[model samples]
Target chain A: EAEVAQSPRYKITEKSQAVAFWCDPISGHATLYWYRQILGQGPELLVQFQDESVVDDSQLPKDRFSAERLKGVDSTLKIQPAELGDSAMYLCASSSRGTGYGEQFFGPGTRLTVL
Target chain B: AQSVAQPEDQVNVAEGNPLTVKCTYSVSGNPYLFWYVQYPNRGLQFLLKYITGDNLVKGSYGFEAEFNKSQTSFHLKKPSALVSDSALYFCAVRDKGGAGGGNKLTFGTGTQLKVEL
Candidate 1:
């Protein structure tokens, strides 16, 4: 069973600092996604990537958050000058294809705690 | 805009009893619904999905979900619940109307099910 891999399962940082999370999707997956799950709320998609390019990032906070998937394999999400409100579980997921409604496989996620 | 709704915040069921976690969705076209389970400190695991065909779709961990188009619901069910089944369950849907193409899934608020022995 190929699993989505994530690094730095836990992270803590003071406000106004920078933080980054990494994700490696399952092999052969063509689409990748980043989601933020706040306390007591469901995961909200922050960005979507098709291969090496970003398809949608409308929900992401442009001033502080950014994500990239280079070579269409591994992805990195970075937060600059993190705020307390930026604390949440950053999840990475991938699907085999962007069409035909394929089910996504998720990573363990990196829990960010900004104080 | 596709969205999923999980009405109950929590559900309690005794071990060996039948269980059901309710889910409803709003979509523009034919819906592709899914159910996922998440344990503490872990990621969401795919359970099952409904794309087309039979309304009853069986999935992992002895779980199943029934799709009711008229009611616009896809509720997860288990014939016999176990203590190991206690976890946070989420329902999701892919936006059929969005122009961003495919592969975007919107999740529900999640339902925490506690199967007590």
Candidate 2:
């Protein structure tokens, strides 16, 4: 079975520092997602990508967070000037595009801690 | 707005016993409901989904969920619980009205299931 790939499984950064996480979704999957999972909370969507285009970034904090999926094969989520509240497990997921009921495949996630 | 709720924070069940995790969703238009499981230190894994069809939806690892549209509920079930099934479970939903909902999923808080011997 193909799996979603994520790198830098853990990161510790000081507040006000910049950090980035990477994800490579399964091949042929056209929809990619970035989510933040705070402790004891479910994953919250930060952005969604269709092919190489961003479909949604409504919940993403534009002032500090940015995401890109150039070429649509993989994606990167970056946060500049990280805040303490930004500490959480960053997860990446992907699924077949244009399906009403497609299953989403998830990556192991990168745990970010801001001091 | 679309949202999902897992009423129970935790559920304890003995091995070999049946188990059920409750989930309720609120969304406009037709809703696509989903169930996912997360093990310790791991990301969420897809379990099942209910789109348009019979209310009962079967998924991976002997898990199933029943979608009750009138009540706005989709409850996950397992006939025989195993220690391996112990994990955090989440319920999710997507609203058809939302733009490009085909890509985004809204998840519930989550329910931790502990199966004891």
Which candidate should be chosen as best, given DockQ against the real structure? Answer: 1
**How well does candidate 2 match the true structure in TM-score terms?**
0.96
DockQ of 1: 0.76
> Runs in model 2 with CA error above 4 Å?
none
* Model 2 chain A worst lDDT window (10 residues): A95-104
Count of clashes, each model: 0, 0
Query: For residues A1-115, could you state the per-residue lDDT of candidate 1 as single tens digits?
Result: 8999998999999999999999999998888889999977889999988889998898999999999998999999999989999989999999887445758899999999999
**Number of the top-ranking candidate, with lDDT as the measure:** 1
Per-residue alpha-carbon lDDT of model 2 for B1-117, expressed as tens digits?
888999999999999999999999998888888899999889899898888899999999999999998899999999999999999999998756655565478899999999999
Tell me the lDDT of model 1 at A103.
86
DockQ of every candidate structure: 0.76, 0.70
lDDT per residue (tens digit) for residues A78-115 in model 2: 99989999999999999886465747899999999999
